[model samples]
Target: MATLNSDYLIIGNSAAGVTAAETIRAKDPYGTITLISREPHHVYGRPLISYLIEGKTTLDAMKFKPETFYEDHKITALLGDEFEALTLDPEAHEVGLKNGDSIGYGRCLLATGSVPFTPPIKGLQGKSNVFTFITLDDAEQAWAAAVEASLKASESGRCSRVVVIGSGLIGLKAAEALSHHLDEISVLELADRILPTVLDPEGSALLQRLLEPHGITCYPGLTADEVLGEGDQAVGVRLTNGECLDCDLIIAAVGVRPNSSLALEAGAQSGRGLIVDERLLTSLPDVYAAGDVVQVCDVLDGSEHPLALWPNAMHQGKIAGRQMAGDETALFHGSFAVNAVDFFDISLLTAGVINPREDMGCEIDIYAEDNSYAKFVKQDGKLIGYILLNRPQNAGIYTALIENGVDLDSLDQDIFLETPQNLDFDNEMRWERLHKFYPRDLDRRGWKEKI
Candidate 1:
């Protein structure tokens, strides 16, 4: 039980924690900074785990920064340490740790992130071969198990199959990875379509077509009733429709829930995630929260939602870091829940508000084709949301318009009605907004030179 003292103490060391450290160093280079992480490895991009499983990249390449990032910034690193509790003392400006140690901090950040939510299906417990793909360790174990299952089937002359329970990004990636080695692969989703919260029906159809060529079967609108196992190892799963599929590997990608238990125990306000203000500060003073562990306001919807995107986490972390370092230079402007996915030969990108309610007095416009579709939602003369499929080049432009609340009423509605290719930005209003956002590009194009 050792004690530590630092000007800033950060718990968790993935996207949010790492960004916070760099931001703090950027603002206050002389302050003592301590970062604690339960992971043994330094900061690495978690999204690359799927590529690693598919043998597309090596572990070394996935390092977020460099091995010496902490040392280079004169920051103390604590690896393989879990944050068990948080006890704040306002008068002393100190926090108590579960390791029987205390840290005296002028400011503290909670970036504890989230944990995979594995539903309690019958026979799921005590299964040796069932795994979840979340952490690096989780990916390592799943990859190893997949390899072993493949080898055993080859040596013992048995069929190898894998059932992935979820149709979200993680589940799809896992199914793709297992499809490379397994004899058969199936994805089970309780929702009516894949990527229910992200992609619409047409977008999901394109994805399904891409997966079919790779021998991945998707069973949407189906729920897992039980994990069928022989002895201690999972052998298959029983579907709610009374269908049993034989599988040697089972990867649970049901989704994730914010890990806010410590914050809750510390009397911090908790909703779907730790509630934080615009400054990323929690209800408690000198205590801040970010990353997937915090519920942030959706700038578009004006409702609290969990933005689990990596970029959102990093941005939130930077804001929290700056505010904690005594610089009120930034605010967590919130996230638009943007996400992109590339599988097989199809690529999809979506951002901002989605699925506008028909009764919300919003106008919806769509341009659809067999290969692509662009949908835009306008409310009160402002662009609210957009969905782009197959065509990704103009996504940035649409995202900017929606995020900046650019007025679209003056522009010709026919521009959005036509195919994205037929659209032109010659309109004064559109050009003005576009140039404002891309001033450097405009300068490079000599458009600003004449002005």
Candidate 2:
């Protein structure tokens, strides 16, 4: 096998891995850094793939970093290659590639991201018209196939139909994009509401209504038992409620499961994701994990959950890279889920635990109107969580307060009604927000028992 030597080998080329490489270059200017990915394209925002299908942006515009990013950082990129195994041992610490080659590393970071969770529905795979809206290639193929399907209906003057399974962020974004391309777009969610992971039922309902004008219909509380097809082509989707909807194309946006088995098989600690301590190290020596593949402290209830958002991945990657470069003080400040998405003009921002259990002793305040909705959640008089829609201007301040535990007792009720000004915050909080790192765990209250 051909052997490639490196001081740092990062598996995956998106946010976490790339950020890690950048951070490493700052510390060790002469060390060799190798970043690999299954995709051939340069790193781009995964979330923007849906917008590419919707015709809002071109593939070139999707590039998050310039082409010179790797060259400028003095990093070697192994794109369009799949990682097969970790050949770390006494003799050589390296990663095996799908091809007959291995890239040896002094320290390896596993930032391999998640893959789409394919639901257990019959006749879903091997269908030419079926696709997952996750990667850039997935978006390109889905859009090309959808255009071909549209040409078939040119004589009939009817719109091609697109069914997006799951009403989470991926599903809604796909539906929104396909609505502009096809005649009909329907979102089928197994849950009763959309964005169940982000927004509560009330916020979800508002989003559903806002999406109606975009020519997209959402069917909640529906599960797909089978994907009906005709001779290797997807024709319709069969739901558990005894209804079959015609579909020219289907985009599976159910959810994503962490790609942690590689580390687990290599004998690393893992649960829903690769488990890590404050140092972000795995069970094995000289091996660390970051990004969507690793579980992080939620800090809300002192639980570990996959904060798969891009920002968290970038932050974790920086910390992991610093730690790998010999910074023992690089401890994780903790993370929770935070998502902000705009669909056809209706902007939604959800941070932390939106709906805390009643037994958790959280105070809830809601403001809902025709086009705006905001829900604030607090524990011990400090902001803990919030969900805002249509009104996203001052959303950052609210999120800062949640992470830093700003006492809500001082703020007037008008904080929710308008964009909160800097004067609204105490001088200390304002200074930290503008100058220093916002302290996430400086508060006195301890972790309470989960109800």
Clashing pairs in 2: none
lDDT of 2 by residue, 262-309 (tens): 677677878888888778888778888899998888888778777788
Tell me the TM-score of model 1.
0.90
Task: List candidate 1 segments past 4 Å from native.
Answer: 81-99, 412-423, 426-451
Write the residue-wise lDDT of candidate 1 on 251-309 in tens digits.
99999999877678677888889988888999877889989999978888787878888
Which candidate comes out best when scored by TM-score? 2
Model 2 clash number: 0
Against the true structure, whose lDDT is highest? 2
Estimated TM-score per prediction?
Answer: 0.90, 0.93
Error of 1 at 202 (Å): 2.7
List per-prediction Cα lDDT, in the order shown.
0.81, 0.84
Superposition error at 116 for model 2 (Å)? 0.7
